[model samples]
Target: MSATAEQPPFRPRTVLLIVGVAVIAFAGFLLLIAFAPPFQGGHDARGHALSTSGNGYAGLVELTDAIGSHSLIVRDTDLLGSSALLIVTPEYDSDGAQLARLLAARAGHPTLIVLPKWLTRPMPDNREWSLKVNTIWPEGAIAALDKIAPKLAVDQTPFRKTVIPPQPAAIPRLARAAIGGQREQQRLVGMGFTPMLLDRDGRVVMGKLIGRPVYVLADPDLLNNQGLADPWTARQGWQVIDDLSTTNEIAFDLTMNGFAKQADKSPLRLIFQPPFLPVTLCIVLAALLAGLHGAVRFGAPIAAGRAIAMGKRTLVDNAAMLFRAARREHRVGAAYAALTRDLTAQATHAPARLSGEALDHYLDRAGRNAGDPPYATLAWRAEAAEDRDQLLGAARALYRWRRNRTR
Candidate 1:
């Protein structure tokens, strides 16, 4: 019963199964964290560019990309100063002050504001789909712009929720750009701005701030996924994009749509965003390496050494330590010199009767005759030593003298 077993405590197959499951779980977790829907590479059913739902502008983003234009979804407010064309869709209840700050921070970049209109609720059974409750009130829809556009008014044409495609999408179909020209029912009757796009009604579906690059899109039906779902509307939307864009990059902002993890001054998300993302990944990799190293045994376990080592070297070291503590090493130089002289004499076949100065003189004579160095100077120096350093120095000299003379 006290014998070592041939088999290990854990079965090989069982251990492999557990490790396989753990590895799979960890990989899945990392994939989920690194590539979710908000990054525009996956599914999100909201009303933003990341969302592929009816009201989202994901189709417009794809259209931009297909035409060799760069499309980006900026998650950081720090990216507001970008000189590319920026498209923002702010929710009805989003902070007005934040919006003002965002617009102010644009540093003269061209921006297109898409005001929110639909009021919808996510379906309980399918998170990727939503149910349209109704249209948002015109006053509520346009109130967020009051800080920047105070004189801005919001009104829908009498025929409007016969709407959904920003015709003011009805005029192109009903009026056919009739001889009166297209101003029949403009969505924005606001004065002092240049119209960028007009329906057959001649209303400004898209307008620019006077002398500024900022443009306002009062009706989103012309750009939203639902609007672009139709072939004609999609074509019209693409034409509007191509005309108003001043740069190659088209950035859709989701911070105003409430998707920024760094929102609310939280620094925890800073590690997952740019510049710091690589650092965070390095830390994760180092931790995984540490865990892997700990999981496997690298070599045989080292045996515990005895508390008091048993050897001549240990005994010598202990004696040296004791002599150091008692300050007696300085007094042993002469004794060492005598022992070295006697040992050298025996090796050289000298007379056993030789002692003291006679032994030293005889050894020196014999060494000179044999072309070896004299031992007398080292012996004299060792005997006259006064401290540990001097003693050690003299002892080393004496050891060389004996070794050379004997050899």
Candidate 2:
């Protein structure tokens, strides 16, 4: 009995299919890695990059959450609707009018404006920042502050202390809470605000306007990550958040943190958002499917074709086509004239001594037939022909003369 062939060992088509699947899987893995967010360390200490683990106010965010207060960082200004408090941490180059408008929008809500203090650089490992306290606010911040709250004086010197005493009336837990840090100072030397929270020396660290919902906290270190590192400061920080939780919800303003809305949406932005991602995925999948379909043959392999076995007739037809494509019809007349003359002379066995017009006359006499034009007349007509119709008539006459006279 004849053994059945083992499916030609294995189909190359199957091997190709496996390779294609592997390539597709690899591409997907690369896309996932490329678009995914970068991994971060426990503390992202970059200035104004508001992450919950950031040294900015992430600790305060956690504290608010622990105490049953609904806390959120306001990335979009539209969400800055009526709320209990809108905490703005103003940055360098902040716009004065924009700040004013935001405060005006939240007319009923209290705003706690915190001045920036640190000059910092990222760590070598890229996890956090190395900090240096800058006493002077940036020129832009100063201009914005002048416009927003002209009466407030932001102190240049940091008050160095191992411990800080807190007022319990405003922050009830502050007296027992751990409060440690060099206080960056601010006070309303002019007449718009009253002291709400004071340090052991009785200096106003936090204050509020007489009739407005506006409040000002001079020092950011009291609640930042570096400050929260100490137990006392962390407690004091919690106390501050607890005091601010007058309403159920507490909104942190990210507008000053440089998270503003763009006036226009880019096309590339649409491709990533939910509305267009599915359409983009569909297009990519269709392309991949089309590529897969074209990758492998379905049935039998096509036989190999000969590289150099073209017939003479095909070569002639191709050459004719090349002449037509080049618009070389004007050259055809001269070629035909020379060919007809040579053949006629050879067929008649005319002597070489019979030159020029004498030779032409002899061939013309020999080539003339009852229904045909003389070879001399045809040759002259062909040489003089310019247009298509004249060239066509001259060609036909020469062809007939050669056929009738040569034989």
Segments in model 1 whose C-alpha atoms lie over 4 Å from true places: 1-44, 159-186, 264-407
Q: List the residue pairs that clash in candidate 1.
A: 166-169, 182-200, 182-201, 182-202, 183-201, 183-202, 184-201, 186-203
The candidate scoring highest on TM-score is 2
Q: What overall lDDT goes with each candidate model?
A: 0.73, 0.65
Best by lDDT: 1
Model 1 agreement with the true structure over 1-407: per-residue lDDT tens digits? 55567567888679878977997898677655654434544244567887777667888899889889999887888888888888998867877787788899898888988877677777777766667787777777776677777666555656443323354433332223221122223266556566666655455566777866878877777788877776666677677677677888899998888676456334554567687989988997897788678877899999999998999999999998999999989888778987998788889998878787888888888667555456767777888888989998998878877777877
How big is the positional error of residue 155 in model 1, measured in Å on the Cα after superposition?
1.3
For model 1 the local lDDT of residue 33 reads 60
lDDT of 1 at 317: 95
Candidate 2 residue-wise lDDT, 1-407, digit = tens? 34675446658888878877998897677655544322222255544536433347766666677778877767677777757677787765678788887887886677787666665545666545554545455343345567666766544444333333444565332342223555444333344677777655555667776777777765666777677777877777667756765687778887665565431244554575688889988997998788767875688988898774599987878877887888766567877898778877787789989877888778777745546765566777897887768888898888777777777
TM-score of each: 0.51, 0.56
- Superposition TM-score, candidate 2 onto the true structure: 0.56
